[model samples]
Target: MEATGRLPAVRGIDAAAPFRWLGWAWRDLWTTPGPLLLYGLLISATSLALSWAIYRTNAAFWVLALTFGFVFVAPMLAMGPYEAGRRLDRGELPRVLDLLLVRKALRQDVAYLGLALLVIYFFWGRIAQIVYGLSTWQIYRTIPEFLTFALTTAEGQRMLLVGSGIGGIIAYGTFVLVAVSAPMLLDPRASVFAAVATSVRAVSRNPGPMLLWALVILALVMLSAATAFVALIVVFPWLGLASWRAYRELVAEAPEPAAARPLNPVATR
Candidate 1:
């Protein structure tokens, strides 16, 4: 915000901040239910379709990839919900069109962020395949068989341990980049670099609370996946809104544009 050279400074939140975000997100969701819930359903459907595609392949590795991959790709998918959160903040109800075809999300900086995450996603998938291949000569095709191997056998257990360790490092690094960047893109003032810079600062500044936040998101996503993503219709939106709150609270807002910005229906509020 200052001469485009210095980005906004992040404020450190207490460990309880993540928990409080849930309450705010829940309120925002119902306050603008029609659009946000519909948006969540859309994401849930996409998740189910993606999971089903991998299930059809009978490749347990991709299944595992897709499960953890949710954490990697979720922030990109949550852009619409971020807009919804912004709208709610301004006392405006988001419309279905706004949620579906988000104008702000279509810009170049977001595209860069999306591309970076996509690359990270594929890299994670490749690493997963490598781990699975190294774990055993025989590939486990069926989910049940894979489950037995993963849960009961020593080789399978070791594979999980090693893979999770690697994946956790990658996931946490991805989180540091995306913790606020994705939502910050909603503002015209934020370029991807500045957004990511601010995101990294916030998490590094408050690791304990941010780690708790990350774990909370993983737990919720796992629960939703357990239901074949039925719970995601609610949980996804809740998290998305919470993420917006995370951005708003973590970093101070940029100064308003000098000229009158384009009139947005939500901005009018």
Candidate 2:
């Protein structure tokens, strides 16, 4: 539904807002640990799968691609915590089933948005491969091999500079699209295009605080990746909930339903 009459006013937040969002997210995580933790476990499994792929192929490029690629597609995955935060805000405990229910609810919007991101991620991987190929003819079989070449060779340095520069642009674009749209999609009244518009507008109106938020996300995601993604068990859900906080602060808060219901209800007999 397009609110062409008066667009939702995006509030201008200060740099400190991102830190505040993190605090709120921390609270949301502990309040509904079961569902949020299940979400984290799923991320852990994905990390393991990626690690297995990298090890099997001995393709260090994949490692680099996935390391940054996660930030590109995290909003959709973080939908679980966003839903949890929404329920918790409504004075209800979010059930594990909401994980599935939230996905179902945003099926149309998320599918389109998620696909757009997946395309960008694939393009990024291809570009990374090209950069690596140009920089080094030899494929690295291990982390040490890759790091030595990357840190010592001029070609390797150039590749790092170019690849990261392009990746940063892509990541910023993805952030602008979904920083608020994912949560907006969760709202029963919001349409995909409308949510996207609001998200872009929100970033445009509050670039300083939004950039701070983006940096916070990058730092946290990098930290999670550093622990072989083990830290993702907590970082993933924490960021998800934190994103919900960001959306809440940026857009005018939607009115909660008068009567709350489980995200997923039992099937009728």
Candidate 3:
């Protein structure tokens, strides 16, 4: 989606948007880490439970993969900043328990997220096929005087490189879209498409900071893996709050009134 307009000009490139985002993120952590932690635990538990159930069933690879995709959508409603925003606006503290109670909104969000995931998966599948075809061609070319040897070597390397590239593209797209869409979805005023579009445009316009953000996310994911995924309890909430704050910063808004009461912060369902 196209950016609404060029990013607003500020005084110094050195004082960039991401640094400002970092500051907002820090403030959220300090003021509301308890709520964030609760949200994270809810997300992590449901996700792990779904994944373990699928794994234990010895499901087909594609079946397991699709189930995993569905699992991600389920938690989006719970972990999404948009849900928090809605709750905050209503003067309710965001809580994991809200997910159990907010059935209608949760269902609506799940449907929206599921549709997005399907579209993403369709494109991703095509990209995977392309890489597999390339790999097969490479293996065929690598077949030595002995057809078996050269073919196998060439195919393996081709598949490896092409698969990696496809994965990278998918990862980058997911990051850009997921970054802002959740919060947008939570806002009663915003449409899902608008949120996704805005997110994509935000990253496109601010490539440098977005890259740094992506790196930070990746590092967190790596650290989580090292901790047997336990680190996500902290990392997920931190990033979720960070994303909400980042969305507010990147998107334009009117200045707050000097004497107005602070906006109520809510958790997304």
Candidate 4:
């Protein structure tokens, strides 16, 4: 069950395709505005609650790390949107309860993928803590103190430089692994190995578009976090829907009507 029989062919795309994906996401968002917005709110609330807990405990360092590691859990968080997108793609009305429950993702491989992401998250946290510990013996529990030290001290600058470099590498690897895999798993035939392999191929074949997509996602998600997750109510759903669009185009080779296809459609199932 490690592989989903065989890998699906990846379609190449132009770098500007991510923008169109966002447009499609916007269009899809309105199809079931109430359920989708409510879904986004639910996730936003969960994220806010987690962030509040960290802030409450005065874990300033973790708050910063969590922001950087937010994408780690994103694929898992995106299940609902992916479900909605897939339903919409099939010319079927996306069921409210189905989108809400995301029952399709309650499979063994999904659990395995979630565990992998969880491990990556904790590993990144530990590495970030080590970097901070090496930079300064004293821990800054408060946000103001941490921000001041991180912005002013030479050691803090060095820590930021090194940590960012390491984090970027890890993030890119995670992106490749989860990009198509997450949504691909919704199919009963998908396995962790096949999904990951297909995702890697999708990135490898369309490096430019994939990187552009990754950056767009990063910028938007960070912007949402910058607002203390208030924007996440909309941003997360937008990105999730877009991610699902990306997955369908890159992983599944389903034929689409001319009106539905974006740019040059490449269906190679």
Top-TM-score candidate index: 1
Worst 10 residues of 2 by lDDT: 260-269
| lDDT (tens digit, per residue) of candidate 4 on 141-243 | 8989998999999998999999999998999999999989998888777788888888999999999989999889899888988888888888888888888
**Any runs in candidate 4 off by more than 4 Å, and if so which?**
1-4, 252-269
Under the 3 Å rule for N, CA and C atoms, how many clashes does model 3 have? Answer: 18
Question: Model 1 over residues 194-265: C-alpha lDDT tens digits?
Answer: 889989988999999999999999899999988989999999999999998787778766332232441122
lDDT of each: 0.84, 0.80, 0.53, 0.83
Per-candidate TM-scores read 0.92, 0.91, 0.63, 0.91
Q: lDDT of candidate 1 vs native? A: 0.84
**lDDT score of residue 65 within candidate 3:** 34
Q: Candidate 2's C-alpha lDDT? A: 0.80
Instruction: Rank the models by lDDT, top first.
Output: 1, 4, 2, 3
Residue-level lDDT of model 3, residues 117-147, one tens digit each, is: 6677676656655655554543232212223
Q: Quote the lDDT for 231 in model 1.
A: 95
TM-score rank, highest first?
Answer: 1, 4, 2, 3
RMSD of 1: 4.0
Q: How close to the true structure is residue 131 of candidate 3, measured as C-alpha lDDT?
A: 59
